[model samples]
Target: MEPLIISTRPGVRHHQLDPVGPGLTGRVFAIPLPTTPLLTDALPYVDWSDAYAVLTPLGAPCRDPQEWAEAIFQGPALWVRALFGVRELVVRLVGIEPGGGHAFATVNWRRDEVLVGTDQRHLGFRASVLVEPGRVALSTVVQVRNRRGRGYFALVRRIHPWVVRSMLARASRTMAGPS
Candidate 1:
Protein backbone atom coordinates (compact mmCIF):
# COMPACT_ATOMS: atom_id res chain seq x y z
CA MET A 1 0.00 0.00 0.00
CA GLU A 2 1.12 3.54 -0.69
CA PRO A 3 1.92 5.81 2.21
CA LEU A 4 -0.76 8.25 3.40
CA ILE A 5 -0.30 11.92 2.74
CA ILE A 6 -2.28 14.60 4.57
CA SER A 7 -4.61 16.33 2.13
CA THR A 8 -6.70 19.42 2.69
CA ARG A 9 -10.43 19.57 2.07
CA PRO A 10 -12.13 22.74 0.93
CA GLY A 11 -14.53 24.12 3.53
CA VAL A 12 -13.37 21.35 5.79
CA ARG A 13 -11.92 22.47 9.09
CA HIS A 14 -8.95 20.10 8.95
CA HIS A 15 -6.26 22.41 7.66
CA GLN A 16 -8.63 25.38 7.73
CA LEU A 17 -9.17 25.25 11.49
CA ASP A 18 -12.56 26.87 11.73
CA PRO A 19 -15.68 26.61 13.85
CA VAL A 20 -18.30 24.31 12.44
CA GLY A 21 -21.23 25.37 14.57
CA PRO A 22 -22.12 27.47 17.58
CA GLY A 23 -19.67 26.68 20.35
CA LEU A 24 -18.44 23.83 18.19
CA THR A 25 -15.02 23.66 16.61
CA GLY A 26 -13.92 21.19 13.98
CA ARG A 27 -11.00 20.21 11.74
CA VAL A 28 -10.70 17.85 8.82
CA PHE A 29 -7.42 16.24 7.84
CA ALA A 30 -6.92 14.09 4.77
CA ILE A 31 -5.05 10.83 4.49
CA PRO A 32 -3.57 9.88 1.15
CA LEU A 33 -4.09 6.23 1.73
CA PRO A 34 -7.20 4.39 0.56
CA THR A 35 -10.06 4.25 3.04
CA THR A 36 -10.63 0.61 3.86
CA PRO A 37 -7.04 -0.35 4.41
CA LEU A 38 -6.43 2.87 6.27
CA LEU A 39 -9.24 2.21 8.70
CA THR A 40 -8.32 -1.42 9.03
CA ASP A 41 -4.70 -0.66 9.75
CA ALA A 42 -5.26 2.49 11.77
CA LEU A 43 -8.48 2.59 13.79
CA PRO A 44 -8.15 -0.58 15.79
CA TYR A 45 -4.87 0.48 17.35
CA VAL A 46 -5.37 4.23 17.72
CA ASP A 47 -5.61 5.54 21.27
CA TRP A 48 -5.02 8.54 23.49
CA SER A 49 -1.66 7.10 24.50
CA ASP A 50 -0.71 7.00 20.85
CA ALA A 51 -1.79 10.60 20.48
CA TYR A 52 0.06 11.43 23.67
CA ALA A 53 3.21 9.79 22.33
CA VAL A 54 3.17 12.25 19.48
CA LEU A 55 1.71 15.21 21.33
CA THR A 56 3.22 14.62 24.79
CA PRO A 57 5.84 17.33 24.59
CA LEU A 58 2.89 19.70 24.32
CA GLY A 59 2.07 18.92 28.00
CA ALA A 60 -0.78 16.42 27.86
CA PRO A 61 -1.22 14.29 30.98
CA CYS A 62 -1.17 11.32 28.59
CA ARG A 63 -3.07 8.97 30.84
CA ASP A 64 -3.77 5.60 29.28
CA PRO A 65 -7.47 4.75 29.33
CA GLN A 66 -6.84 1.12 30.16
CA GLU A 67 -4.52 2.02 32.98
CA TRP A 68 -7.00 4.48 34.35
CA ALA A 69 -9.84 2.01 33.94
CA GLU A 70 -7.80 -0.63 35.66
CA ALA A 71 -7.12 1.78 38.45
CA ILE A 72 -10.84 2.20 38.88
CA PHE A 73 -11.92 -1.37 38.23
CA GLN A 74 -9.32 -3.33 40.09
CA GLY A 75 -7.18 -1.32 42.51
CA PRO A 76 -6.07 2.25 42.15
CA ALA A 77 -2.85 4.06 42.84
CA LEU A 78 -3.19 6.73 45.49
CA TRP A 79 -2.50 9.43 42.94
CA VAL A 80 -5.01 7.99 40.51
CA ARG A 81 -7.66 7.98 43.17
CA ALA A 82 -6.78 11.50 44.14
CA LEU A 83 -6.75 12.75 40.58
CA PHE A 84 -9.95 11.03 39.52
CA GLY A 85 -12.24 9.84 42.30
CA VAL A 86 -14.43 7.83 39.97
CA ARG A 87 -14.51 6.46 36.41
CA GLU A 88 -17.08 9.08 35.47
CA LEU A 89 -14.73 11.78 36.67
CA VAL A 90 -12.01 10.35 34.49
CA VAL A 91 -14.35 10.50 31.49
CA ARG A 92 -15.10 14.11 32.21
CA LEU A 93 -11.41 14.84 32.57
CA VAL A 94 -10.33 13.00 29.45
CA GLY A 95 -13.15 13.81 26.95
CA ILE A 96 -14.20 10.16 26.61
CA GLU A 97 -12.12 7.05 26.14
CA PRO A 98 -10.97 6.66 22.58
CA GLY A 99 -11.15 3.18 21.03
CA GLY A 100 -14.02 2.50 23.39
CA GLY A 101 -11.91 1.41 26.43
CA HIS A 102 -10.73 -1.41 24.23
CA ALA A 103 -9.36 -1.50 20.71
CA PHE A 104 -12.22 -0.18 18.53
CA ALA A 105 -14.72 -1.34 21.11
CA THR A 106 -17.01 1.67 21.10
CA VAL A 107 -16.78 2.80 17.54
CA ASN A 108 -19.93 3.17 15.43
CA TRP A 109 -18.71 1.89 12.12
CA ARG A 110 -20.35 2.20 8.72
CA ARG A 111 -19.47 1.61 5.13
CA ASP A 112 -17.34 4.69 4.67
CA GLU A 113 -17.33 6.41 8.00
CA VAL A 114 -16.62 5.67 11.64
CA LEU A 115 -17.85 7.81 14.55
CA VAL A 116 -16.84 7.92 18.19
CA GLY A 117 -18.04 10.43 20.70
CA THR A 118 -19.05 11.24 24.25
CA ASP A 119 -21.51 13.67 25.78
CA GLN A 120 -21.23 15.00 29.30
CA ARG A 121 -22.97 17.67 31.30
CA HIS A 122 -20.36 20.22 30.32
CA LEU A 123 -19.21 19.06 26.93
CA GLY A 124 -19.80 16.90 23.90
CA PHE A 125 -17.36 15.63 21.32
CA ARG A 126 -17.72 13.61 18.16
CA ALA A 127 -14.87 12.57 15.90
CA SER A 128 -15.27 10.84 12.58
CA VAL A 129 -13.37 9.47 9.64
CA LEU A 130 -14.95 9.76 6.20
CA VAL A 131 -13.62 7.75 3.32
CA GLU A 132 -13.54 9.57 0.06
CA PRO A 133 -12.42 8.92 -3.44
CA GLY A 134 -8.62 8.64 -3.50
CA ARG A 135 -8.22 9.60 0.16
CA VAL A 136 -9.54 9.36 3.67
CA ALA A 137 -10.54 12.18 6.04
CA LEU A 138 -10.47 12.54 9.81
CA SER A 139 -12.41 15.20 11.67
CA THR A 140 -13.47 16.21 15.16
CA VAL A 141 -16.47 18.24 16.25
CA VAL A 142 -16.47 19.57 19.81
CA GLN A 143 -19.30 21.34 21.59
CA VAL A 144 -18.95 23.12 24.88
CA ARG A 145 -22.18 22.78 26.77
CA ASN A 146 -21.44 24.88 29.80
CA ARG A 147 -19.04 27.27 31.51
CA ARG A 148 -16.67 24.50 32.51
CA GLY A 149 -16.53 23.12 28.99
CA ARG A 150 -15.90 26.59 27.66
CA GLY A 151 -12.91 27.04 29.90
CA TYR A 152 -11.46 23.69 29.01
CA PHE A 153 -11.75 24.27 25.28
CA ALA A 154 -10.38 27.76 25.67
CA LEU A 155 -7.22 26.36 27.18
CA VAL A 156 -7.10 23.52 24.72
CA ARG A 157 -7.98 25.57 21.62
CA ARG A 158 -4.55 27.10 21.37
CA ILE A 159 -2.97 23.68 21.17
CA HIS A 160 -5.83 21.96 19.38
CA PRO A 161 -4.38 22.50 15.94
CA TRP A 162 -1.01 21.20 16.95
CA VAL A 163 -2.57 18.17 18.54
CA VAL A 164 -4.60 17.51 15.40
CA ARG A 165 -1.58 17.90 13.18
CA SER A 166 0.51 15.62 15.34
CA MET A 167 -2.26 13.06 15.27
CA LEU A 168 -2.41 13.22 11.49
CA ALA A 169 1.34 12.98 11.27
CA ARG A 170 1.32 10.00 13.56
CA ALA A 171 -1.40 8.33 11.55
CA SER A 172 0.46 8.99 8.36
CA ARG A 173 3.60 7.52 9.80
CA THR A 174 1.77 4.54 11.17
CA MET A 175 -0.27 3.85 8.06
CA ALA A 176 2.21 4.90 5.43
CA GLY A 177 5.34 3.56 7.04
CA PRO A 178 7.57 6.05 8.85
CA SER A 179 8.44 9.11 6.82
Candidate 2:
Protein backbone atom coordinates (compact mmCIF):
# COMPACT_ATOMS: atom_id res chain seq x y z
CA MET A 1 0.00 0.00 0.00
CA GLU A 2 1.10 3.57 -0.64
CA PRO A 3 2.22 5.67 2.29
CA LEU A 4 -0.09 8.31 3.73
CA ILE A 5 0.89 11.95 3.36
CA ILE A 6 0.23 13.98 6.47
CA SER A 7 -1.43 17.34 6.01
CA THR A 8 -0.92 20.15 8.49
CA ARG A 9 -3.99 22.12 7.59
CA PRO A 10 -7.37 20.69 8.39
CA GLY A 11 -9.00 22.29 5.36
CA VAL A 12 -6.60 20.87 2.76
CA ARG A 13 -8.36 19.11 -0.07
CA HIS A 14 -7.12 16.00 -1.80
CA HIS A 15 -7.02 17.75 -5.17
CA GLN A 16 -4.75 20.39 -3.69
CA LEU A 17 -2.00 17.79 -3.31
CA ASP A 18 0.06 16.40 -6.17
CA PRO A 19 -0.81 12.70 -6.24
CA VAL A 20 1.13 11.95 -9.42
CA GLY A 21 4.54 11.74 -7.81
CA PRO A 22 6.75 8.64 -7.95
CA GLY A 23 5.73 7.35 -4.51
CA LEU A 24 2.12 8.49 -4.53
CA THR A 25 0.23 5.64 -6.13
CA GLY A 26 -2.86 4.71 -4.17
CA ARG A 27 -1.96 7.49 -1.79
CA VAL A 28 -3.97 7.97 1.38
CA PHE A 29 -3.77 11.52 2.63
CA ALA A 30 -4.02 12.27 6.31
CA ILE A 31 -6.45 15.12 6.44
CA PRO A 32 -8.33 16.97 9.13
CA LEU A 33 -11.65 15.73 10.38
CA PRO A 34 -14.24 16.95 7.92
CA THR A 35 -16.67 19.55 9.16
CA THR A 36 -19.60 18.08 7.31
CA PRO A 37 -22.91 18.74 9.01
CA LEU A 38 -23.66 15.08 9.38
CA LEU A 39 -20.40 14.32 11.16
CA THR A 40 -20.59 17.44 13.28
CA ASP A 41 -24.07 16.58 14.48
CA ALA A 42 -23.13 13.00 15.16
CA LEU A 43 -20.01 13.74 17.16
CA PRO A 44 -20.21 17.18 18.66
CA TYR A 45 -17.22 17.21 20.99
CA VAL A 46 -13.85 15.77 20.04
CA ASP A 47 -10.85 15.50 22.32
CA TRP A 48 -8.54 13.91 19.82
CA SER A 49 -9.30 13.49 16.12
CA ASP A 50 -7.73 12.21 12.90
CA ALA A 51 -8.89 11.67 9.35
CA TYR A 52 -7.51 10.07 6.20
CA ALA A 53 -8.78 10.36 2.65
CA VAL A 54 -8.28 8.79 -0.76
CA LEU A 55 -9.53 9.62 -4.23
CA THR A 56 -12.79 7.99 -5.10
CA PRO A 57 -12.20 5.97 -8.22
CA LEU A 58 -14.81 5.89 -10.95
CA GLY A 59 -17.20 3.00 -10.51
CA ALA A 60 -15.52 1.85 -7.34
CA PRO A 61 -17.30 -1.09 -5.77
CA CYS A 62 -17.66 0.72 -2.45
CA ARG A 63 -19.01 4.07 -3.53
CA ASP A 64 -21.04 4.73 -0.44
CA PRO A 65 -19.30 5.87 2.71
CA GLN A 66 -20.92 3.09 4.67
CA GLU A 67 -19.67 0.57 2.14
CA TRP A 68 -16.11 1.84 2.45
CA ALA A 69 -16.38 1.74 6.22
CA GLU A 70 -17.64 -1.80 6.03
CA ALA A 71 -14.88 -2.86 3.69
CA ILE A 72 -12.29 -1.65 6.19
CA PHE A 73 -13.80 -3.37 9.23
CA GLN A 74 -15.24 -6.43 7.53
CA GLY A 75 -12.28 -7.84 5.61
CA PRO A 76 -9.92 -5.58 3.69
CA ALA A 77 -8.03 -4.44 6.78
CA LEU A 78 -6.95 -7.68 8.38
CA TRP A 79 -4.72 -6.08 10.98
CA VAL A 80 -7.60 -3.94 12.19
CA ARG A 81 -9.66 -7.03 12.74
CA ALA A 82 -6.86 -8.63 14.69
CA LEU A 83 -6.52 -5.54 16.82
CA PHE A 84 -10.25 -5.54 17.45
CA GLY A 85 -10.04 -9.09 18.65
CA VAL A 86 -7.46 -8.12 21.21
CA ARG A 87 -9.55 -5.16 22.25
CA GLU A 88 -12.53 -7.41 22.72
CA LEU A 89 -10.64 -9.64 25.10
CA VAL A 90 -9.35 -6.75 27.14
CA VAL A 91 -12.69 -4.96 27.31
CA ARG A 92 -14.53 -8.17 28.17
CA LEU A 93 -12.23 -8.74 31.13
CA VAL A 94 -13.35 -5.38 32.41
CA GLY A 95 -17.05 -6.23 31.87
CA ILE A 96 -17.53 -4.08 28.81
CA GLU A 97 -19.41 -5.35 25.77
CA PRO A 98 -17.28 -7.67 23.73
CA GLY A 99 -16.58 -6.06 20.35
CA GLY A 100 -18.81 -3.11 21.21
CA GLY A 101 -21.91 -5.31 20.78
CA HIS A 102 -21.48 -5.23 16.99
CA ALA A 103 -18.98 -6.35 14.43
CA PHE A 104 -15.84 -4.43 15.36
CA ALA A 105 -17.89 -1.57 16.76
CA THR A 106 -21.44 -0.32 17.15
CA VAL A 107 -22.62 0.87 13.76
CA ASN A 108 -25.13 3.63 13.19
CA TRP A 109 -25.78 3.83 9.47
CA ARG A 110 -26.68 7.12 7.85
CA ARG A 111 -27.39 8.31 4.33
CA ASP A 112 -23.89 9.61 3.54
CA GLU A 113 -21.91 8.11 6.37
CA VAL A 114 -21.76 5.31 8.92
CA LEU A 115 -20.82 5.96 12.56
CA VAL A 116 -19.04 3.28 14.50
CA GLY A 117 -17.77 3.46 18.06
CA THR A 118 -18.11 2.51 21.70
CA ASP A 119 -18.44 4.45 24.94
CA GLN A 120 -16.63 2.80 27.76
CA ARG A 121 -16.23 3.65 31.43
CA HIS A 122 -12.90 5.17 30.57
CA LEU A 123 -13.41 6.73 27.16
CA GLY A 124 -15.70 7.12 24.18
CA PHE A 125 -14.78 7.13 20.49
CA ARG A 126 -16.63 7.66 17.25
CA ALA A 127 -15.40 6.89 13.75
CA SER A 128 -17.06 7.77 10.48
CA VAL A 129 -16.63 7.44 6.73
CA LEU A 130 -17.83 10.40 4.71
CA VAL A 131 -18.41 10.23 0.97
CA GLU A 132 -17.54 13.52 -0.64
CA PRO A 133 -17.58 14.56 -4.29
CA GLY A 134 -14.28 13.01 -5.38
CA ARG A 135 -12.87 11.54 -2.24
CA VAL A 136 -13.74 9.28 0.68
CA ALA A 137 -12.72 10.41 4.16
CA LEU A 138 -12.45 8.28 7.25
CA SER A 139 -12.36 10.06 10.57
CA THR A 140 -12.14 9.15 14.23
CA VAL A 141 -12.84 11.23 17.31
CA VAL A 142 -12.24 10.39 20.92
CA GLN A 143 -13.47 11.96 24.16
CA VAL A 144 -11.80 11.09 27.36
CA ARG A 145 -14.03 10.88 30.42
CA ASN A 146 -11.44 10.29 33.10
CA ARG A 147 -7.78 9.96 33.94
CA ARG A 148 -7.69 6.35 32.77
CA GLY A 149 -9.25 7.42 29.51
CA ARG A 150 -6.56 10.01 29.03
CA GLY A 151 -3.81 7.50 29.72
CA TYR A 152 -5.37 4.93 27.42
CA PHE A 153 -5.81 7.37 24.58
CA ALA A 154 -2.24 8.55 25.04
CA LEU A 155 -1.07 5.13 23.90
CA VAL A 156 -3.61 4.80 21.12
CA ARG A 157 -2.93 8.27 19.72
CA ARG A 158 0.61 7.29 18.81
CA ILE A 159 -0.46 4.42 16.58
CA HIS A 160 -3.87 5.65 15.45
CA PRO A 161 -2.52 7.39 12.37
CA TRP A 162 -0.70 4.39 10.99
CA VAL A 163 -3.66 2.10 11.63
CA VAL A 164 -6.19 4.36 9.93
CA ARG A 165 -3.87 5.00 7.00
CA SER A 166 -3.37 1.31 6.39
CA MET A 167 -7.07 0.59 6.66
CA LEU A 168 -7.96 3.39 4.27
CA ALA A 169 -5.34 2.30 1.72
CA ARG A 170 -6.37 -1.36 1.91
CA ALA A 171 -10.06 -0.59 1.57
CA SER A 172 -9.47 1.83 -1.27
CA ARG A 173 -7.43 -0.68 -3.23
CA THR A 174 -9.87 -3.51 -2.53
CA MET A 175 -12.82 -1.50 -3.74
CA ALA A 176 -10.97 -0.17 -6.76
CA GLY A 177 -10.04 -3.67 -7.89
CA PRO A 178 -7.23 -4.29 -10.40
CA SER A 179 -5.29 -1.35 -11.80
Candidate 3:
Protein backbone atom coordinates (compact mmCIF):
# COMPACT_ATOMS: atom_id res chain seq x y z
CA MET A 1 0.00 0.00 0.00
CA GLU A 2 1.23 3.48 -0.76
CA PRO A 3 2.05 5.76 2.14
CA LEU A 4 -1.15 7.16 3.59
CA ILE A 5 -1.63 10.64 2.17
CA ILE A 6 -3.19 12.64 4.97
CA SER A 7 -3.53 16.39 4.95
CA THR A 8 -1.48 18.14 7.61
CA ARG A 9 -2.71 21.50 8.88
CA PRO A 10 -2.56 22.99 12.36
CA GLY A 11 -5.35 21.59 14.53
CA VAL A 12 -6.69 19.75 11.49
CA ARG A 13 -7.48 16.15 12.39
CA HIS A 14 -7.56 13.55 9.66
CA HIS A 15 -9.05 10.06 9.57
CA GLN A 16 -5.75 8.85 11.05
CA LEU A 17 -5.44 11.30 13.94
CA ASP A 18 -8.74 11.12 15.77
CA PRO A 19 -8.69 7.72 17.43
CA VAL A 20 -6.65 8.67 20.46
CA GLY A 21 -7.38 7.55 24.00
CA PRO A 22 -7.42 10.40 26.47
CA GLY A 23 -7.03 10.23 30.26
CA LEU A 24 -6.61 6.49 30.02
CA THR A 25 -2.89 6.25 30.33
CA GLY A 26 -1.73 2.83 29.17
CA ARG A 27 -5.28 1.80 28.58
CA VAL A 28 -5.71 -0.11 25.34
CA PHE A 29 -8.29 -1.21 22.77
CA ALA A 30 -7.90 -4.72 21.43
CA ILE A 31 -9.31 -6.00 18.12
CA PRO A 32 -8.99 -9.31 16.28
CA LEU A 33 -8.21 -10.12 12.64
CA PRO A 34 -9.84 -13.24 11.25
CA THR A 35 -7.70 -13.43 8.11
CA THR A 36 -10.38 -11.53 6.26
CA PRO A 37 -10.66 -8.01 4.97
CA LEU A 38 -13.91 -7.38 6.77
CA LEU A 39 -12.05 -7.27 10.05
CA THR A 40 -8.31 -7.29 9.54
CA ASP A 41 -7.79 -5.43 6.27
CA ALA A 42 -10.42 -2.85 7.12
CA LEU A 43 -8.08 -1.53 9.77
CA PRO A 44 -5.26 0.79 8.72
CA TYR A 45 -2.80 -1.74 10.03
CA VAL A 46 -3.56 -5.11 11.54
CA ASP A 47 -0.62 -4.51 13.91
CA TRP A 48 -2.79 -2.00 15.70
CA SER A 49 -4.89 -5.00 16.61
CA ASP A 50 -2.04 -6.06 18.86
CA ALA A 51 -2.47 -5.48 22.59
CA TYR A 52 -2.20 -7.25 25.92
CA ALA A 53 -5.60 -8.85 26.04
CA VAL A 54 -5.16 -9.20 29.76
CA LEU A 55 -4.98 -5.40 30.07
CA THR A 56 -7.28 -4.41 27.23
CA PRO A 57 -10.89 -5.29 26.53
CA LEU A 58 -13.57 -4.34 24.00
CA GLY A 59 -17.32 -4.63 23.66
CA ALA A 60 -20.04 -4.36 21.03
CA PRO A 61 -22.12 -1.22 21.44
CA CYS A 62 -21.98 1.33 24.20
CA ARG A 63 -24.83 0.41 26.53
CA ASP A 64 -25.06 3.93 27.84
CA PRO A 65 -23.25 6.72 26.07
CA GLN A 66 -23.57 8.86 29.16
CA GLU A 67 -22.17 6.15 31.40
CA TRP A 68 -19.61 5.09 28.82
CA ALA A 69 -18.44 8.67 28.34
CA GLU A 70 -18.02 9.00 32.08
CA ALA A 71 -15.76 5.95 32.15
CA ILE A 72 -13.68 7.33 29.28
CA PHE A 73 -13.38 10.57 31.16
CA GLN A 74 -11.85 8.54 33.97
CA GLY A 75 -9.89 6.19 31.79
CA PRO A 76 -10.16 4.27 28.51
CA ALA A 77 -13.28 2.46 27.51
CA LEU A 78 -13.52 -0.41 25.06
CA TRP A 79 -14.18 0.51 21.42
CA VAL A 80 -16.59 -1.50 19.34
CA ARG A 81 -14.89 -3.55 16.64
CA ALA A 82 -17.12 -4.42 13.70
CA LEU A 83 -16.26 -6.97 11.04
CA PHE A 84 -18.12 -7.69 7.86
CA GLY A 85 -19.05 -11.31 7.29
CA VAL A 86 -20.13 -10.85 3.73
CA ARG A 87 -19.53 -14.25 2.23
CA GLU A 88 -19.38 -12.80 -1.29
CA LEU A 89 -17.87 -9.37 -0.72
CA VAL A 90 -14.22 -8.71 -0.01
CA VAL A 91 -14.05 -5.90 2.51
CA ARG A 92 -10.99 -3.87 3.42
CA LEU A 93 -9.84 -0.29 3.85
CA VAL A 94 -9.30 1.12 0.39
CA GLY A 95 -8.35 4.33 -1.36
CA ILE A 96 -10.49 6.01 -3.94
CA GLU A 97 -9.79 5.37 -7.60
CA PRO A 98 -9.85 7.46 -10.76
CA GLY A 99 -6.92 6.34 -12.89
CA GLY A 100 -4.80 4.08 -10.70
CA GLY A 101 -6.25 0.75 -9.66
CA HIS A 102 -7.66 0.56 -6.15
CA ALA A 103 -5.27 -0.44 -3.40
CA PHE A 104 -5.59 -1.54 0.20
CA ALA A 105 -5.21 1.10 2.86
CA THR A 106 -3.39 -0.06 5.98
CA VAL A 107 -5.29 0.30 9.23
CA ASN A 108 -4.07 -0.33 12.76
CA TRP A 109 -6.30 -1.90 15.38
CA ARG A 110 -4.63 -2.24 18.75
CA ARG A 111 -6.89 -2.53 21.74
CA ASP A 112 -9.34 -0.48 19.67
CA GLU A 113 -7.12 2.60 19.80
CA VAL A 114 -6.16 2.41 16.12
CA LEU A 115 -3.25 4.71 15.34
CA VAL A 116 -2.39 5.78 11.77
CA GLY A 117 0.95 7.53 12.21
CA THR A 118 1.53 10.78 10.34
CA ASP A 119 4.54 12.08 8.45
CA GLN A 120 3.73 15.67 9.29
CA ARG A 121 3.51 17.03 12.83
CA HIS A 122 1.45 20.15 12.27
CA LEU A 123 -1.98 18.55 12.49
CA GLY A 124 -4.38 16.68 14.76
CA PHE A 125 -3.63 13.40 16.48
CA ARG A 126 -2.27 10.84 14.03
CA ALA A 127 -4.31 7.78 14.96
CA SER A 128 -7.26 6.22 13.20
CA VAL A 129 -8.92 3.24 11.47
CA LEU A 130 -11.77 2.85 9.03
CA VAL A 131 -14.48 0.65 10.50
CA GLU A 132 -16.75 1.22 7.55
CA PRO A 133 -17.93 3.80 5.07
CA GLY A 134 -20.06 6.58 6.58
CA ARG A 135 -19.74 4.80 9.88
CA VAL A 136 -16.11 5.57 10.61
CA ALA A 137 -15.33 7.25 13.91
CA LEU A 138 -11.92 8.53 14.94
CA SER A 139 -11.09 8.90 18.62
CA THR A 140 -8.85 10.92 20.99
CA VAL A 141 -8.64 10.33 24.74
CA VAL A 142 -7.27 12.05 27.82
CA GLN A 143 -5.01 10.35 30.34
CA VAL A 144 -6.34 9.99 33.83
CA ARG A 145 -4.24 8.94 36.82
CA ASN A 146 -7.02 7.25 38.75
CA ARG A 147 -8.68 5.18 36.06
CA ARG A 148 -10.70 3.09 38.43
CA GLY A 149 -11.87 6.03 40.51
CA ARG A 150 -14.85 6.72 38.28
CA GLY A 151 -18.15 5.02 38.93
CA TYR A 152 -18.70 4.12 35.30
CA PHE A 153 -15.37 2.40 34.98
CA ALA A 154 -16.12 0.53 38.15
CA LEU A 155 -19.25 -0.91 36.62
CA VAL A 156 -17.80 -1.64 33.18
CA ARG A 157 -14.43 -2.87 34.35
CA ARG A 158 -16.14 -5.24 36.67
CA ILE A 159 -17.84 -6.77 33.67
CA HIS A 160 -15.32 -5.90 31.00
CA PRO A 161 -14.42 -9.50 30.23
CA TRP A 162 -17.98 -10.63 30.22
CA VAL A 163 -18.93 -7.75 28.01
CA VAL A 164 -16.10 -8.38 25.58
CA ARG A 165 -16.82 -12.09 25.36
CA SER A 166 -20.49 -11.41 24.98
CA MET A 167 -19.78 -8.82 22.38
CA LEU A 168 -17.38 -11.12 20.59
CA ALA A 169 -20.15 -13.64 20.36
CA ARG A 170 -21.55 -11.37 17.67
CA ALA A 171 -18.72 -9.08 16.79
CA SER A 172 -19.91 -8.98 13.20
CA ARG A 173 -23.18 -7.60 14.36
CA THR A 174 -21.61 -5.22 16.86
CA MET A 175 -22.59 -2.39 14.58
CA ALA A 176 -26.00 -2.39 12.95
CA GLY A 177 -24.47 -3.03 9.53
CA PRO A 178 -23.80 -0.40 6.82
CA SER A 179 -26.13 2.53 7.14
How do the predictions measure up, each by TM-score? Answer: 0.44, 0.73, 0.20
Q: Write the residue-wise lDDT of candidate 1 on 1-179 in tens digits.
A: 22222332232222234323222111223223233432333332221110111121222233333322222223423543343345446555656532233322324656556655556555555555554333334555555666766765666555545545544444433333221
Q: Which numbered prediction scores highest in TM-score against the true structure? A: 2
Best by lDDT: 2
| Model 2 C-alpha lDDT per residue in residues 1-179, reported as the tens digit of each score | 44334443353222112233223546787665677665565544566666778887555444676667777767746677677668778766755555454534645767778788877677777788887666778887776788767776677676677777788888877777653
Return the lDDT, model 3, position 87. 10
How far residue 86's Cα lies from its native spot in candidate 3, in Å, is 32
Model 1, runs deviating above 4 Å: 1-15, 18-107, 177-179
Tell me the tens digit of each residue's lDDT in model 3 across 93-178: 22111111111122334432343332211111122333322222223211112322233223423343334333322332333333
Query: Which model, 1 or 3, shows the larger lDDT?
Result: 1
For candidate 2, the 10 contiguous residues with the lowest summed lDDT are: 13-22
Q: Give model 3's TM-score versus the native structure.
A: 0.20
Better of 2 and 3 by lDDT: 2
- Native-to-model Cα distance after best TM-score fit, residue 155 in candidate 3, in Å: 2.2
Off by over 4 Å in 3: 1-143, 146-149, 172-179
Model 3, residue 135: displacement in angstroms?
A: 23
